[model samples]
Target: MSLRQTYRLWAPMYDVFLKPATRSARAKNLAQLGRLDGLNLAVIGIGSGLDLDWLRLHARPAQCIGLDITRAMLNKAQIRRRDCPFPLHLIEGDAMQTPLASGQFDYVVLHLILAVVPNPAAVLAEASRLLRPGGQILIFDKFLHPQQKAPLRRFISPLLGLLATRTDVEFEPLLAAHSELTCVRDEPLLARGWFRGITLQKHPINQHPINHHKD
Candidate 1:
């Protein structure tokens, strides 16, 4: 099924569906963003804004923009809205093709989104493009680690992979493979049996100096 169709089915139960199964899996990813005060933060495929509380408590970002392809998801987020609107922007767009300009953000965060996209590399490239020099990006999603424990990951992971954006895709090496971005942190919040969470820094794409995004 297409991501939109899958999301159409999931938009209602997404938080509940993810929470029970991926609770331990998603916590640290949420926790990692708390320190990003005053930064321009853009979150792609931000489902229900369930993680907003954690992000706000931690990062205190100067602005927050949430983007998702499904309007239902964005509408749901509006109902769950936290008290402060502090520079909040909502855009209906695809991660692989955003309406925003290049190098237009200080940080980008994706929570369990890549695996389900039709093109994970395209989304990653977008992540690379939207980020300003020295900008940081955080990704929390499934990875089919060849080096992992077999018996455990064997059962649950394939299902996650099946449900993930790019079925059976591996994002672990892709994050490390790129020279433009540096791996600042890698943590396994789940059973560490299968999936992994990653935080990476966007090194300057070129010799250009930092030209941060305009509001």
Candidate 2:
């Protein structure tokens, strides 16, 4: 079965297996999103809407949007949304190419998706495209530090990918490739040193040179 299919089967048991990590990441990331009362936020790989509770604590559900590719996962998220204290926009869509308008969100959340998604660069690009200039992206996932080397793990990464996640995604290069994105914060979130909470900000549009048309 494909990775999406595997995740579809795991959807029912997803929260049970990931609750601890999810809770910790949520608290850490949410702490960085201070005073979210009026900001529009989008959770790119919203999964089963597990972060809804944390988001609601900081902002109203109306200010939040959730997106994911899998319908099964979205179905579970719908259940979660129904139980939420307020309503939120939940759309079944791909992170690399979501239906959300450009510069629509003041903040974009990318929790545990870098390794799960096939093209991390494309995903980041889309997130950047969706975010308003100067907006921040809160990313929580397992990734190798730019300077670290893991030859053995890299060799087995393909086998690991069979289970639905890549084992060795390096964050620095991805951030470096995007001139508009700057890594403002990076810290280890899980004790094993495998997972991290990173915050990146997209530079304002005017930061780049503009081409003017002759009047």
Candidate 3:
């Protein structure tokens, strides 16, 4: 089956598979978006609307767009969106291509989607293209360790990528290298830097230099 087809088969039970993230347990390691009082945002890969539960509490974005490759995912999201007090837009599209006007968003979030897509960089590049200058991209997913670029990881990661991920990418450099965006902060899982929550601000080249140094 194709990548999306795999998900479509599981779409009926997708929400049952995913749940309200445990706060002090597995959830603590994920991204913590403090507050979004007034932000124009778009979320790529809004799988099963799990993040929407958290977003409803944290942000009141003017326009919240959720895009994904699976139509069933969008269907579930649509049901969830109805309860949302703010605007919620759903689009069926690929990660590499966002059907949004360039330079139109204030904030965009990948929220762990990169780990499952076919082209991680292309997804991120599209994110940059869709954001207005000074807009930001927030990413949360598994990225390879900086010091330990093991041969084992290189081999295993791609195979895993074939099943459920796009790139077993080194996201730190990709976020750092872009002149239009700056990696302001990175929150890592306690023992491993493999999974992390990242904040990248687009354009004007500004950041206070986040310390991703291992503890």
Q: Pick the candidate with the highest lDDT.
A: 2
Would you list the C-alpha lDDT of every candidate in the order shown? 0.71, 0.79, 0.71
Candidate numbers, best lDDT first, in rank order: 2, 1, 3
Model 2 TM-score, 2 decimals: 0.88
Candidate 2 — worst ten consecutive residues by lDDT sum?
206-215
5-93: candidate 2 lDDT, tens digit per residue: 87798799898888765697668766777455446789888888788766655555237788988888888888878756555788888
| Model 1, span 70-93: residue lDDT tens | 887887777655554466677889
Give the root-mean-square deviation of each candidate in angstroms.
4.5, 6.5, 5.1
**True lDDT of residue 149, candidate 2:** 84
Highest TM-score: give the candidate number.
Answer: 2
Residue 7 lDDT, candidate 1, scale 0-100: 78
Expressed as tens digits, the lDDT of each residue in 1-215 for candidate 3 is 56688778768987674563323223443234434445578888987777777666555777888998889878888888877888888999988987788987777888767777766778888999988776778887777755665677678776766655644577856666567877777777433656677777776644322222221
TM-score-sorted candidate list, best first: 2, 3, 1
